[model samples]
Target: MKTKYWTIVVLALLTAMMSVAPASAKPVTVKGKVTAKEDGSVIIGCSVLIKGTRNGTLTDTDGKYAISANTGDTLVFSYIGCITQEKTVKSAKLNVVLQESPEALKESMVTGYTVGESVEDVSSEEIRIMYVPVRQELPSEEYNEIVENGFMKVKDTPLSTFSIDVDAAAYGNMRRYLNKGQLPPADAVRTEELINYFSYDYAKPTGDAPVKITTEVGACPWNPVHRLVRIGLKAREIPTENLPVSNLVFLIDVSGSMYGAERLDLVKSSLKLLVNNLRDKDRVAIVVYSGAAGERLPSTSGSDKQKIKDAIDELEAGGSTAGGAGIELAYKIARKNFVPGGNNRIILCTDGDFNVGISSGKALEKLIEKERETGVFLTVLGYGMGNYKDGKMQVLAEKGNGNHAYIDNLQEANRVLVNEFGATMHTVAKDVKLQVEFNPAQVQAYRLIGYESRLLQDEDFNNDAKDAGEMGAGHTVTAFYEVIPAGVESDYAGKVDELKYQKPEKTVPVSLSKELLTVKLRYKQPDGDSSKRIEITLADDKANKVSVDFHFASAVAMFGQLLRDSDYKGTATYDKIISLAKTGLGKDAKGYKREFIRLVEIAKGLDKE
Candidate 1:
């Protein structure tokens, strides 16, 4: 009877355990490789996630990932610039070849010049007019820096500091991807640049400083729990006649990679337009690099436009790249003809492939940083795609106290070189840095929208030796920060335990009780070493005012956040972004704002697919 009772107890316990367990409780390790279906090439850094769970992992450089899941559990594979896919785990090995999503492939063949069909299929005259080829295009291998800004507690981290970035390359590159019917890589959608690309109407400064500061705060468009803060820095506009004489060196990359008309031919045409805009008081030199660097045209007065045009037209693409040698030689030429108080600059045009020597971006940065002390600026004009090295170009421009632009077509070229000539070539402020201190009493946490690569250590803000971005005349730089109001719970918010050894002080202060945040800016005059400081305080007011520019910039910020799939993009969607952008389509003389609205609409349609 005792043995029978014991057997019954064991049987009952087993029955309960079996009934409670999941139907497919046993888990097996699933392994897979994610490759491009078309080329069978392994995709690096693709995301692999278990369905209905937070468990996920990224593919290694070899595009392989292993995750533990039960039979019938779904697995998802996703990557930027590619379509997302899902599979149920039936067996242990579930390799996947991700086909380019219809959305990514849909608009890719639409080369902005023509609406439909390949350039080769078009009439000969039409093909000649567009200057595009019939050859199949390859995916862009361009690299961009990635930086994610996380929410910071005002008490633990009071100060937010970063270098000011005026480069608008990201904006144009994004346009290229959109036109091709594909979403850009997450790294390619920089919020700050997208916001700063368009001009904003801000009050000019009446003081000694070359830049005026503007600030506005309002309820965030995407997140009701958060508020938006806009900081605008506008450089004083200078008349073209009063601008300094320019000493320009045109550095052209003639490597075989540039043989395509979209590369070398387009560059030549763009340079001609710039040559035509040159003043007789200015000087121009031409340098070409292809396996070796050499002078294409000796320093010639800008008055000799024909000579410059001739040299530009004669450029041919062949041989390997010697970009480092070309850069050094161009700088040497510019220095030899350097004029005091003049706009001395080297304008480097390339796809940014530097193969021969000193090719690494870090080494190139050190070289450019060392050369910039000579008071010469650099202008990086990126041309072509697929092989464009945007990261290297950004580093060179930032370190050399200059600017960067991406030229996709003649229209874009004109926009950068002609429409904004003074702003592109003239530098009014150097090493500009911004630091914001938020009041913990009113704010729970804050995250900068963009400029991840431009983030600087708090101590670096006041350091004169550290390099920052340069501001050009009439150029406006804008940045956005999202703030979570006090009492709001956010995933991005941090929790800290009470200190054992120290006493907790009051959250509010008498002096700064009513203040929202203090914005501090430090910058050096175009040629000065020491820095000048500017401070402005924002009040914590219930009534918030929003401007068209502010709304428009906010829309752009949302667009970037969505592209990057940021965790902080609360309640953001393409339709909402489109609506916000539509509100600001007023007085868009250049149609840039309208263009943004159209892009948003396109993205909306694509997202649905």
Candidate 2:
């Protein structure tokens, strides 16, 4: 009887203890902001990860982030150029400030043209210790000349025709120069690219069309006497889950010139970010070049992200650049693993320093042009600064029906590879050309703001065979035209000598219409060879108020002109650009426009020096 009573008492005690035990700690939402310790500026694209887990998120434009974590769990915060931090999830909120890492800063040393350098006498350890930061301009950097477009009389040149350009490399490259406390070369300042680098609030296509067009006319901030016409095209946006399968070929330049942290190292990190975003349906192949071309990674399923990342991490920079060979190998791999009616692209990451066979711009253009016809599109991602061949990159991208971008930092890499993935990887429209017919009655003279190299013959607008630019999913292209209204006398509208042998042609009756201009666009489906045309006529709607985008884009254009010291930059000053930019700083959620404002200030200071 005593044993039975004790057993019952023990059971009761055990049951009571079980009932009193606490449940597993429920996960709580942890949120915080990350900033730089030096300037207290919010750090964009910072990576936040939960310890011992694959769960991670990047900070938004405002440097704010949220993630679920259990009590006592550890959180890791990391970013390029900043020291990594860790904190225990003791509360629902934990802010982090990362100090600049000295080691990371030292890795940014500019080593100019290390190709074919004899290092046999120096040991690897000695070389490491001797590698120090050199802050001198590299004379080997190259740029194509850009001549400003002159105003043409509307009567003589009613049609302004050009291929649409989506490349923003010039803007980023210019920013690199400014960040180094120097003005970018005039040839590096492409006005249209600078204006189009920032996103604008344009309407997406509602119908089967892949692109939508928006137009606005406003008084030019630089020259109040002239009107600025803004033409914008917005590609349709597709959700991440709904995107087509992607067959990507990563063409990496492992040449000696790309040995710096800002070059090959940045490329690896950038590509790793891309790998993280890949879907199971997507496949990737890596082709690298240094003196020769070779496949580093075969076509692997995106599910094997770690394997792909490992391949990228193993790449080392050395030897002469065999860029053409890399291109050939990449395209071959892309074609071998082509996804029909899907995204098939070769992403060429390089500093554009090609010294081996088929290196000239014309020869590279021909090679890429021939390869591009195989239904494989190209994307040129430039890296590094000294010995950068911007001209070669531009030619390859332009001829290959591809876009170009310069990745100056890891934040820029995140912007291109993570935030704008679809727009950077997938194509919606190809061979996009625009022709604007101005009404002689409403406009006396007009000139295209930029696109000096993109000018197409008027007949090329309707020619389906002529290659032009490609617009990616959710991509936005903007063009600005300075218009001198009828009867407005300006120096830009120069007097021309009359031809005695030529007789004046009769004006069309349609010139009397109230329309200011008619914009016609022609583009082809991603997989189609034929082209389709869209036309829209803009009337002189004086009631339409100028949008914030107009002001912001104009400010960028003015800044570009100032950088170039263009003759047409009338009354444009850094102060004026800043004030105009502030007025247009609407809902800058990503803080890109805010960053632009800061860049303008930097440029102003550099100009004074």
Candidate 3:
């Protein structure tokens, strides 16, 4: 009854406007001002374009931008990190509101490559270069003319959104932030330890079989929310048979904040484990970070296991963390023992809880930005969990020309070690990225979920030095995206009124283009310093539901939706995910099938609360 009443009210308003004009007529005047930042203090200069077409308008002196868009046109408002808004302008006067880009606050880190840092930090001596290959939304052109020219205008109200994904790699090389249900205070956190938590699964040296390793991107299919990413390391991984001698450095964070068993103990235990796994051919060094920084161990060989183990066992955690000091000390150690090519690397172990000195973006960016030129690659291992600064860890890794991961326990330790050796130790591909160009004819209004921080600008592509994600030899990463089919309508989140946009577009079903999206990959040999390339294209078949990529990816998406409690989920539920996964258990080669089923039971139990 209420819905019907609202619809009647909407139609009545439309009728009144029609009386002032014609039935099949032009757009009615709808005006609104756009204010920038808080209280509209700053006039924002931005582009107002329709979703698909390139037609748009630029903000004027007052940060006020205007564009004529009709009942069905999806208006896209964009400016840096400010959320890109999309709307279907009904009665035209849209006093658009442009909020400040959250990234605008402290977005100086791109990958681990912090600002004021050298571009080379995005790459390495072996990597040569790195770039954050990205794609930004384009403005709509044709639709704007229709509204401005008064060709198409619907009297009905429409839907709109002021949402845009933050380019995580852009500001701080972060793909994921610490999923805090609630925010944590600074003084209680240790920034350096947070920066180094992920277990990177380092492989032992072998003769050189080009060791293969693997890890799952997320949880067992059973419990989709708890995605499990396994890292496998092996012997002879990243063989030094022909490589230069590496001047290795270890940077550990011993802040007063890292006084817990999970923080300090985890670091010592993980380091001890990694030390035991080292080969006689490798050299090692250690540095620590607190309110101040210090070097615990100088360049030493793997052959002197006792020397390294003794130093590791002698370490203790106390004092506030000075991130800049730790980074500087580590870089200095690497430079002092600078090796021409063997394998210069600084392994950072912390919880990423920097709060004391040099914690700001401009400050840290300038510090790490200048350190990469010496050819020392960085590897960040994050420890602990609560109040974890996952973002900061990713920044250092990205800028340090490395990768980031979170370490919770020993099983995770084994996963990083025994399972993904090549990816952990060898660099099979550098700056690998994914770009999907959706076919509008096949789908409508696509939204990429999660990776909210990974969205990249279009220009970032083609630049070799841009820092993207890293891929180890034989490593597989899975990403899932859910798309709404064209013509599908829902009362919630509808873009336009009536079928105005769908009318001339295609009321009759189109053939549905076969090639849904393309996947392009570029890589470099772990031993070779130059880069190479590879590409694979994915087609949407909508067939063979028995078992397929869509099925798997969809399951993953459903799991994500369930976890995030997204609006897009329909009948999709935890049981449904289990049912689907069980149906397409595939090879079940590793018996992960059984494990998944059990996890489903576990997740169901957790939901009772």
Candidate 4:
């Protein structure tokens, strides 16, 4: 009986060994490639999971993925830029591709910024900020810097983007005056400096609508020291039928300077395009400027589109620029035909090189200082090359309570007019300024990135009459601050005497508000510019999803920060920027955002010189 039992045990052991053979070879192999449906970018970091098994692998550097799974198991490939995908393993090798995700728009790119202490904690009240862009490194001190104004035409697109790039940089030798604990240079502080110094006022938007503030801040991809920041605020696009028809006027500058394919000619063609798109209810007027300005055409409705087109066509570049005369006449014509609540505006199309009366930027600004009281908003459309006056245009947009745009070609005209129509005309808020009184206990020393030209005297704020930039319907404004905690301090800027006599300010906490910045908007109806002010605060902490807006804004702000030559831009370049942007690229429905990343890449490549 013992011998028979031993024989049965040996047979059982042989059966167990035969059963373990199948388990030794983990035979489920998985492989696939991940790509986007639109631009065909390889989807990296995508995970491939073998359903019902404990096996998973990520896509390789090339967006091709591999894993091991058993037959009849499901394979899942998941990534950030594309929709999650799944495939059933019918064969040993499984192939997978990803589609673009539709939910990217609702995502935010920026995380929250570490804020600094409130003003009360600081020892100084008089804060002087010096704005500086990264200057190209010169092998020698006197390399002879070159400043030029040029235009760029996109591939297959008629639009030409204007640029006034500076080789903006400074060396230890450049600031000889700033030696031994000296301050920054004055030439570095440009006209755009003071304008960019103070944060403009704005009104906080409500509900699910997003406020878009898009800007580029970097050494001109073409010219290093010359930083370029183009701000595009896209509010929720409103249907044209809901908004009132604009009672428009084309204030064309037929000055001697306005002669060229890039100037008067482009303006004429751009205006003709507008004439064709006018609504029946819209009224039109024309004002031309030369050595003196004149009313080229009186107000007329779109029923006479051909008449306006003919007048626009009749415009010929001649004489010196008499912008002051044109401004006065344009206002007069607008007043005579002003319609309450109608979109009444005189679009100033020029090269911004005003040599006539009130010709200089300050002079032209003062000239229209009182005219804004008439309630007719201004839209300064800059044209021409060589003498492209960005300074004059910025000032007019600020004082006249309007917006400014540089038009390089016809495609740009459509982008400014057709693509960003409501933003071009509709004023949702005006005189927008940003004010952040950080809780000193929570923050320390903070630095605001960019806006070197937008800083303001604390007193300049809350002064209702002070002029500021305007915001369009559905527009969003974004700014960034790199905070250095109060407990710990570094010598970033020059220390001054105000640090001696200053006492820290302390204030009691009131109701938590959503206003991250107190947006004080002062605007008049399209025709009634006596002006009105609306103040709202934007907050971004718990109990307020306000942080949500801050997230998107922060990402953009960080991008701007990464672009500028900030002392803290450690490893913060285009590669990281694309990564962060890819991570937070929210609902990118129209692919404008995808194009933005592409632009970043292209600009990186274009500016490689």
Cα lDDT, all candidates: 0.80, 0.83, 0.48, 0.51
Judge candidate 1 against the unseen true structure and give its global Cα lDDT, from 0 to 1. 0.80
Per lDDT, the best of the predicted structures is: 2
Best by TM-score: 2
Candidate 1 vs candidate 2: which has greater lDDT?
A: 2
Taking the tens digit of each residue's C-alpha lDDT, what string does model 1 give over 283-386?
Answer: 99999998999999988998998888888878899999999899999999999999999999999999899999878888898889889989989999988877
Q: Compared to the true structure, candidate 2 yields what TM-score?
A: 0.81
What's each prediction's TM-score? 0.78, 0.81, 0.56, 0.56
RMSD of each: 18.9, 15.0, 26.8, 22.9
Which rank order by lDDT, best down to worst?
2, 1, 4, 3
| Model 2 agreement with the true structure over 465-493: per-residue lDDT tens digits | 99999998899999999999888888888
- Estimate, for each residue in 206-314, the C-alpha lDDT of model 4 and write its tens digit: 5542343333322222222222233323344466657676777789989887875446766876676566667788889998889887787888888897888778878
**Which candidate model has the greater lDDT, 2 or 4?**
2
- Candidate 3 local lDDT, residue 57: 49
Which consecutive 10 residues in model 3 have the weakest lDDT in total?
141-150
lDDT of 4: 0.51
